[model samples]
Target: MNTNDSKLREQIAYFGRSMFERGLTAGSSGNISVRLDDGWLMTPTNCCLGNLDPADISRLTRSGVLVSGKAPSKEFFLHEAFLDRRPTDRAVVHLHSTYATAVSCLPDVDPRNVLPPLTPYSIMRFGKVALTPYHRPGDKRLGDEISIVAAEHRAVLLANHGPIVAAKDLESAVYAAEELEETAKLFLLLQGQRPRLLTPEQVAELERVFGEKEDDRAKTCC
Candidate 1:
């Protein structure tokens, strides 16, 4: 592998350890993947994020065939869906983070945008998180659902499952995922209470500024 590929592998491992140690993921309940010109580098199936082996990360071809190392995560469909649709996003992060998953379980959430506009950072980072209907883990069909919302949303909360964030790069995806979790925590905490959410105009301004900057980055990404 070349220098960039080696660096991505190390980065995936490094961030995986950080997320796992901080309880963003439990056991092997999360997955991460990075885009490569030829294919992808993904965390392997049944592997704990905290203990990733950079050398053992799976490398797949452009057509999704495994080229080397371990087998890709069963949620391979999820990663491939995001990277394929979000051309500018370099990484996809999916985590069974506690609070986010709890929010996903709530029956009253708006299916279109689950997280209330609680923080500008959340809105700037997530755009708006779509709430996808429940699908079994590792089920290929879930990718289809993701594809429908992939172009418009930077994140999706899988009903009864967890949250997935796609970002300009691996680190950004991780941070977005963290923000998602925190936002979820706040959402839950504010239940049955009056919390001053950001007004629609405030959210729109954030989208116009930070969100458009992201769009600009996408334009020059290639």
Candidate 2:
């Protein structure tokens, strides 16, 4: 194995543990993936994220065939949908995070854009968070729905499920997922009291400045 692949394995485990310990996800309820030159590295199925072993991370071929380690997560196709549609994206994070899943369960959110313009970072990281139609967990239909919106959105909330985020790298995908959950919490917190949002022009300016470079967004946004 190359040095980069080894590091990516450790990175996945590190973030998986962090997410699990912090309640971003629970049990074996979340998945993560990083695109490689030949294929991808993904968290194994039915494993607690908090207890991931770097060596046990699944390595799959470009065609999604398992090449090493354990079996990939059942939600493999969900990440596949984004990686297939967004050629430039190198990582994908899917989490059954509490607040985001709670928001997904809500009936009144906009189908086209589940998240309102509640925070500048949300608008900056996710231009518009699309809401995919509900499908049972690991259902290929869920991935299919994601494929339809992947062209226009880098992030999506699975109806009655949770959120999935894609980015140029694993760190960004993970951070975006965290940001999504925080934004969801803020959304729910302000449900009764109408909160003012960024104007269209302000959102446009953010899109123009921080949108073009996903990798540089964090460095430049501050």
Candidate 3:
């Protein structure tokens, strides 16, 4: 492997293990992918994130052909949806993290923005997380839904499923995914007990200052 590819392989394994150990995802319940100059590197299907070996991570050509390593996750198009829509995004992380999945299953939460703005980090990292109506696992149409929303949002919650996050790089994607989960945990914890949420003005100010560009605020407003 080239030096850059070698480093990415190690990083992917490290973060995958960390996510597994911290219960961000349970056995074989999550997948991660990173865009490469040549193509992409993705976690294999039905493989425990905690047990990933760098050499076994699947590599794909720019045209989506498998080039090396194990088979790619069945949700390959989900990752592709985000990367194709957002050219700046270099990594995607999808996880069935406990609290976030719980939030997805809620009946009253706004599908337009699944998590409430309990903290600035969540807003900064995720913007507004769009919710895609539930689709059967391995459904290719799910990618179409994700592409529509991901064009304007960096993160999205799949109804009755989990959260998929895209970011500038793998570490940022991982951090944003963790932040989404923590915010979801807080959202559930404070349920029925009115928690002080960041006002719309506060959220707007955060987006103005920390968002990728001024136009991002306009494009991402729900």
Q: Give the range of the ten consecutive residues with the poorest summed lDDT in model 3.
A: 213-222
Give the per-residue lDDT of model 1 (tens digit) for 84-128: 899988899999999999999999778888888988778866768
- lDDT values, one for every candidate: 0.89, 0.91, 0.89
lDDT tens readout by residue for model 3, 50-135: 99999999999987789899999999999998899999889999999999899888887777777888998888777788889889
Which candidate leads in lDDT? 2
lDDT, residue 217, candidate 3: 33
lDDT of 2 by residue, 1-222 (tens): 789999999999999999999999998899999989899899999999999999999999988999999999988898988889999899999999999999999997787888889888998777799899898997899989999999889989999999999999998898899999999999999988979998999999888888776668878656
The positional error of residue 207 in candidate 3, measured at the CA in angstroms, is: 0.9
lDDT (C-alpha) at residue 70 in model 1: 98
RMSD of 3: 4.1
Per-model TM values vs. the true structure: 0.95, 0.97, 0.94
Q: Looking at candidate 2, what is the lDDT of residue 191?
A: 87
